[model samples]
Target: MKKRSLLFPALLCASLTTPSYAMLNGCVDTTDADKKTAVYFANGILTSPYAAENMAFKMGIAYKNQFKNLHEDSSYEFSDAYNYSQGKLTDIAQVLQQKMDEEGVAGISGYQIYELISSGLNNDPIRAVLAAFLSTTTNAIYTDALLEELGELMTSASVEAIADSLMVNSEHIGLYEANLIAGKRVLIMPHSQGNLFTNNAVAAVKTRQPDWADSIDYFGIANPAALTVGGAGYVTADDDRVIGILSLMENVLASNLDNDPSALPSFFGGDSRSNTNHLIVEDYWDARLASRAVIDTNMLRLAQNTPFPLQIAGTGAIRASLSWGGQPDVDLHAYEPNGRHVYYRSKTGDDGILDVDDTSGFGPENYTVACESVNAGTYQIGVNYFRGNATETAKVTVFLGDGRTITPRELMLNQAEGSYGNDNPATMFEITVTDDGEGNAIYSVQ
Candidate 1:
C-alpha cells in the first residue's frame, strides 16, 4: 500500500511552500513558515506547497458523487431531510449549525470551508444549486427532527448565543473558545491536521471553546501500527480533551477515503475485502455468519436420471470440482429446493446413484459436466446421495469455467445436508445464491 507523511509536518510548512492569501478581516491565517523543501527530478516544475487544497478538491468530488447515488424528492431535489437513525449527513449539518449558533461565529467558517471544497470541485450542479439556495436565506434551517434531538442534548443554551459570547470576550485562543461556545462535539479522523480549512478551523474551535477542555473526545480510525513514527498526540480523554475513539469496525467510507484490501489488517473477517462508511454496515458480516442457520431442513439427495443444469455451455474442457473444509464433514449432492433429486449416480456395486459427479472414486476432484452459460443466482447444491448426516456444517466451494480452466463462485456454503439424511428424506434444501445460477460447475463438497 502507499503511505502518506504525517499531516502536521506538511501543514506547518504550507505557507512558506505555497502561495498565501490574506483575508479582509485579518482573522483567518493562511500562512506557511519556512521549512526544508524537497525536489523531484521527474517534473521540472516545483511541487505546489498547497497540500490541503488538493485534498479538499478531491474530497469534494467524492462527496458529490456519493450524494448523487441517494434517492431524490418529487422535483429531483436531493433530500435535505435528516433522521437520527438514517440521514447522517443531515445530522452532522444540524450539529455544526447548532454549535455555530452557540459559539456566535458570524458567517459559519466550518460550513463555508466544507462548502468551498464541495463547490470547488464543480462535479454536482445540483449540490451547487442547493448550496446557493441555503446561502440566500439568512435564517439557518434547523427544522429536521434530528436537529431537535441533538438540541435537547445541549446544555440549555443555543449555539447562536454561545457564538456571540466568544466573539465579544475571551482570553484563550480564538478557535478554542469558538468551538466550546458553539458546542462542538464532532468525531474527527486521525491525520486530519493537514486538511487546511478543517485543521486550523478546528484549532480555532479548540482555543475558543472553553467546554472543549472537558468535552472533546479523541479517537483513531486507523490501525495503531499504521501510525507514522511520532504521530501520536497527547489529549486527556478522562478530562474531555478527547471524548471517544473507535477503530474502523469494517472499513471507513468517507467522501475521499475507502478501505484498501492491501492496507487491511489480517484480523478482519472474510477473504473478500469490503469498504463501508458506517460501523453498522461493517458489522453486517457478523450478522450474516450468525443467520446462516439451516432454515430449510432437508436431506440433500443425489440428482437421479435427471437434467442437471451444467453451468458451462458449448463443449470445451469444461470441468466441475468440489472442495470441503470447516465444521463437520458433508457429502456433495445436487437437487432443487423442493427436495427433488435430479443428479444421482450409483457405483457398480451400490444400489443408490449420484447425479452430479462423474466418478464416485474421484472424491473431491474437479469434474466438468457438460453445460452452457449459467447466469448468476442460487442453484441447489447438495451432498449425501443415499446416507449422510442431517445437520452438518461445512465449507463448500464451487468452481466453474467455460470448458477450459474452471472459475470459482464467490459464495461459500456453511451447511451441507440436513442432520441425518438416512433418517429424514422429507428435509427441505435450498440456498439463496447470486450470479448466473447455472452451467458447467464443480462442487468442492466437504
Candidate 2:
C-alpha cells in the first residue's frame, strides 16, 4: 500500500497527533487543549487526494459512455428524443419535428408522449413507440462491469492494508493521544470504500485500546462496510452508482456471514446498517448536504447526552417510551413493518401496542410488543408534538428483545412548535428484528 500526502496539510496539522502505544501503557498528559478533531477517508478507486479530486471528471466520462451505450442499444436517438420530450429543443429535435410533420405526426409533443408512457397508457400509439424506445436500453452490461470492478478492489486483505497504511502514515503526524481524559471528541469521515478501512481500523483500536474507542465518532458517507456497531453516522446519495453497487455487495456479504463464515474474514460480523448509531439519508446531493449540516451543527448536543435505559419485561419483545422535562404534550409514534401505526388513537396492532399515551404534560408515554406479536421486521419509532411550545426536547429510549437498549444520543425537539407529523416530528431510530436461531428473535437498531 502507498501512503499519500494530506489534502489539506494545515488542517491535518491542527487536528491530528501520532498514536503513542507507549503512552497508553502508562503516563498522563493533562496539558492538551480540548479541541474537536475530524479525519476524512476518500472513496473507492481513489487512494490519494489527487485521485479524489478527479472523481467528477471520471464520472462525466462514465456517464457519457453509459448514455452512448444506451443510445446504441435503443437505436432511436434516445438522448435527443428524451431531451426533446423534457421540453428542450435542439437541432436534432427540429429535424425530428420536420420528419414528424412529413410523417403526419407533427402535433404530438414530446412531453405528451412522455406523460403517456410514464402513466402506463401504453395503448396510445405515441406512448407505445416511446416505451419501446426506452425498454431496449438495458443496464445489465454496466452493472456487470461495476460489480466485477468492486469485487476485485474490495477484498478483506486490501481493506486491512489500507487501514494499516493510514494508521502508519498518521504516526508522525500525531493524532491519537494516550492517557487522554474521557469526552475528548474525534470524528472520522469515511466515504464509500474508505468505510471498509475505517471499520477495520476501529476494530483494531478496540483490540489495542478498548477504553479509548468511545471517544471517536464515525461519520461515514456512502459506506459499504459489514458489521457496523454503535457510535457512527452514515450519509449516502440515492443516485450514486457506487452506493447502489455497494448495497448489493453488502446483502451478499451479510448472507455469507450467516451461512458461510469460512469464506470471509474472521473479524467480519454483519452489516453496519443494523446499528443504533447508524443514520441513513435518502435524498440526493444538495439535500443530503443540508441534512448533514444540521447534524454537524448539533454535534456537541448529540455527543453529551447520557442515554437512559429502557428495561425489557419479556423475551422477544420491544418496548419504547418517551419522556420530557418541560410542560409540553409529546406523543410517541411507532410504525411497524406491516404499515401498522401504533399511537394514541390506534393502540393495539398485530405486532405491537401503545400501553401508555400520556398527553397531560411532562409525562412518560410508552409502547410495547406482546410476546405473540414479536416478528422479524423493521419498526420505525418517532415523536410527534401534539401540543407544545416551540422550545422543548424529548428523550426517547428503546428496549429490545436481545437485551439491547437504544437511546438516541441526539433527538432534540426544539422545532416541535405544536405540530404533528410535519418537519418537526423526529424519527428517533428504526429497529430491525431477525431470527437468532434456537427459536429466538433478536432485535437490532437499523
Q: Show model 1 residue runs off by greater than 4 Å.
A: 1-244, 247-328, 336-369, 373-380, 385-391, 395-446
* TM-score, model 1 to reference: 0.19
TM-score of each: 0.19, 0.30
Candidate 1: what lDDT?
A: 0.26
Candidate 2 worst ten-residue window by lDDT: 75-84
Tens digits of per-residue lDDT, candidate 1, 1-446, equal: 11122322333244244432211111112121111110000000111224323422432333334332332310001111011111333333333333333333445543443443335433244233223424323225544464454434331222322332222122112222222222222322222111112223344443433234333322222121122211312111111111112212111112212222233454764323233222211211122321111100100010011111212111111222332222333344443212223333321101112323322221232222223322222234434323233432222233233211112221233333444442222212233222233322332222
Looking at candidate 1, the ten consecutive residues that score lowest on lDDT are 295-304
RMSD to truth, every model: 30.4, 25.9
| lDDT (Cα, 0-100) at 293 in candidate 2 | 52
The TM-score measured for candidate 2 stands at 0.30
Top-lDDT candidate index: 2
How much is 286 displaced in model 1, in angstroms?
Answer: 28
